[model samples]
Target: MILDRQLLLSNAQALTTGTVFSTNTIDLASARDIGIGDNLELFIRVIAPLTGGTSVQFAYVTSANADLSSPSIIVQTPPVPAASLVAGSEWLRVQVPALSDTTSRQRYIGVQYTINGTFTVGTVTAGLTLDREGLAVYPSGLNTAGF
Candidate 1:
């Protein structure tokens, strides 16, 4: 099953085009059974032509209800030296082990990017999917039917 999904930059610009951000969230009401040994995977695409920035920086935050009480984790992807965005886009895959044994009803994933020194918009279109047996979180591909 899928657990989460998001698109940080839609109209992705070049390293010199400034910064942009977007996000999405997914509910875990159906994923209460997910526990330890399971992992979280994310696929991100930075649209093309990032401009006006020394580099693109992606940041991630995990929470339970968009509240401060929710446990949060941060992850970041630095910029590449290529500077041309040869692929037109890039993908990010992440995994979070069962840090805690809690079965949650909702898990929030936040994402943002900075261009040189400024932060992008906010989390939009970010989502989470379910991974029941931990089988779907492997190296294969995303469980598309989820979330």
Candidate 2:
């Protein structure tokens, strides 16, 4: 059976236009204690015109805090060719095996990117899917339900 524990790693946020680097992190769980054989899928959507030379990286980490000193990279797609991100033509999706020999104490997923040139105008969003064997229920207005 498919689990309904879907999580949003990054909201639909506008990319900064220009040569600037930025990182966005979404703490999935303080202590997921994820077990072996579990899977994680990352979905990335970018509104085209993503400006050429722009680089983006997706990763996940297990830490007591949100500091991503070290992270497990899921995927890093090639930079878009200069002026190649025509409108309506940029998107990526990757599946990751979240298996670990040992249980995790915390699980944090995020994305980092550098806008190398002027992106006409666009937004970036990231989502994560956890495959397990149970359903998750949440209380209203409580963002900490993922913990």
- The numbered model that scores best in lDDT is 2
lDDT of 2 at 87: 46
Native-referenced Cα lDDT, model 1: 0.43
How accurate locally, in lDDT, is each candidate? 0.43, 0.49
Residue 105 lDDT in candidate 2: 35
**Per-model TM-score on C-alpha atoms:** 0.45, 0.52
- RMSD of every prediction: 11.4, 13.6
Total clashes for model 2 = 0
lDDT of model 1, residue 6? 34
Per-residue lDDT tens digits of candidate 2, residues 34-80? 33365666555565445434544333344334655455444466665
Superposed model 1: Cα runs more than 4 Å off: 1-21, 29-40, 64-71, 79-87, 101-106, 117-147
Give the alpha carbon lDDT tens digit for every residue of 48-117 in model 1: 4433345566655555764413434466677643354334344344664333544422365555545564
